[model samples]
Target: MVHFLPDILAFFFIAALIAQRLSVDLRLPDAAYQLITYILLITIGLKGGQAIANNASMALIGHSGLIITMGIVITLVALIIIQIFSKLNKADRVTLAAHYGSVSVGTFAVAVNYLEVSQIPYELTLNLFVALLELPAIILGLYLLSDKTHKLNVKTILAHKSLALIIIGMLIGALYGEISEPLVKNLKPMFGVMLALYLVHMGALAGAKISDIGSNKVFIVSFALIMPLIGASIALFCSWLIGLSHGGATLLAVLGASASYIAVPAVFEQAYPEANIAQALFASLAISFSVNVIWGIELYTQAALLISSL
Candidate 1:
């Protein structure tokens, strides 16, 4: 019974949801939420950059390509699932698939915390994979869309605030490895605190979307619940095939399971305005995000452990 309750950062998320359900009038300011986002993105970037600096290798290039392929495959599969099971229009299907295909940094942060709590060691370069996984889904979504009017803007995607911060942080970390040590040390302690704050904000937002599950209740809810399991299973198999460590496999599975609520929404709103962005966000943030935070993380970790031992 105790194990079923939310613990650690998840407690903040679940508490926020409960508060929202009770109409507690608790919410983080928009500016503060954005600030937290910036901090998290930069922190992940810096840490990953430092790791790459310490362990640069040609193998990373191969691994990166493989990860990108995984993102593409996930997006395609998600689209296929949506097309078959969902009555959403073509644009909405592609857009929603894009949301599932991309990685969620918030979820990644939680998984990282989970690994730390369990004393599991993962490749620091996993953040690099986080950055790598963001683009392919969006790009594929754009390409698949029937709308040919909006050209794929590589520069715009790269310059998106989230990716820019991460890339810049990585560059700084990679260039000034020793010099950035003090900054990383100072920020490391605040990582968990910031993530908890973010999740609190996220939970409130997700709670508000509870009524927005809309007409496709069965399909949306079913997909939201089941997609993470499918995605995590595929990722665990990939991790095993590549011989990733237990922590590495777990983190990868989390990334695979996560659905993007931030980056994908921002891009899709502008690029494909006709798509039902609100419903997509509701599905990804409210249902999928909640599922991952509450139960999926533990399941993925255990599954990773099993795969690593095989």
Candidate 2:
């Protein structure tokens, strides 16, 4: 798996570049993006739900809640630093905060594959954390950006497709458990294939957005690299404190380092129309996504090893 990692990443990245070259005439990347997101989300949700159903225990539920809380804390700490250091407008800062705070499904999925190939076992409930970490950062970022008089619309959030799919998958998992495994047998086997296809679209998206990030290139670039490191640092301490195994700690670090381009962007479109979504999108998809996928996992694993030894 480690040997093939470079090839897999290169294939998608090169494909994305090719797609970008041909994008003037075709909407192939967009079509792929829309189609694969639903597939990935549903598949991820179902897998997590099944794990939860099988392991149903108060401890698991409690751990899940703590994971969500960690996400909120990460968001707050990130926003605070961005607010102090960045010269971007309030809206952009909040947008960046939301993006950094949210989880990246692509990076998370890749980390899972890496773990599987490395023969390291991770908690199945880690699947649920992908979805669990999506919302708090978005809501908190927007809330902080808003004036005291502003009230967020709960209905709008609940209606989001990303959140809805997660809930739907969990409901199915909790009620049906593994009974529906046979039904999804075909789809289950295709998760890796589906992910590779997804990365192609991601690469294309990143290539397209990379050039449009405006004048604050230094700031954006620094934040893209630094924010993930900060998230990884926090998660390292928290995971060890919570007694997560090495694999679990590595995953938490990967997720901590990942920046969301999907769910958070959708949330921002409706919630913070004033914010510059393009910059946030570029930072997450173009820079941070690549950073995490390429070297971020290795960084996390190494960081965990270092921390455990200390």
Model 1 regions lying over 4 Å from their true place: none
Candidate 2, residue 151: CA error in Å? 2.5
Of candidate 2, the 10-residue stretch with the lowest lDDT total is 21-30
Candidate 2 lDDT by residue in tens digits, 218-302: 8888889889999988888877766777788898888888888878888888877778899888888888888787777877988
List model 1 lDDT by residue over 153-250, tens digit each. 77656667887888899899989987888997898899899999999999999988887877888998898888888788878887887789999999
lDDT (0-100) at residue 2 of candidate 1? 72
State residue 254's C-alpha deviation in candidate 2, in Å.
1.5
Model 1, residue pairs in steric clash:
none
- Whose lDDT is greatest here? 1
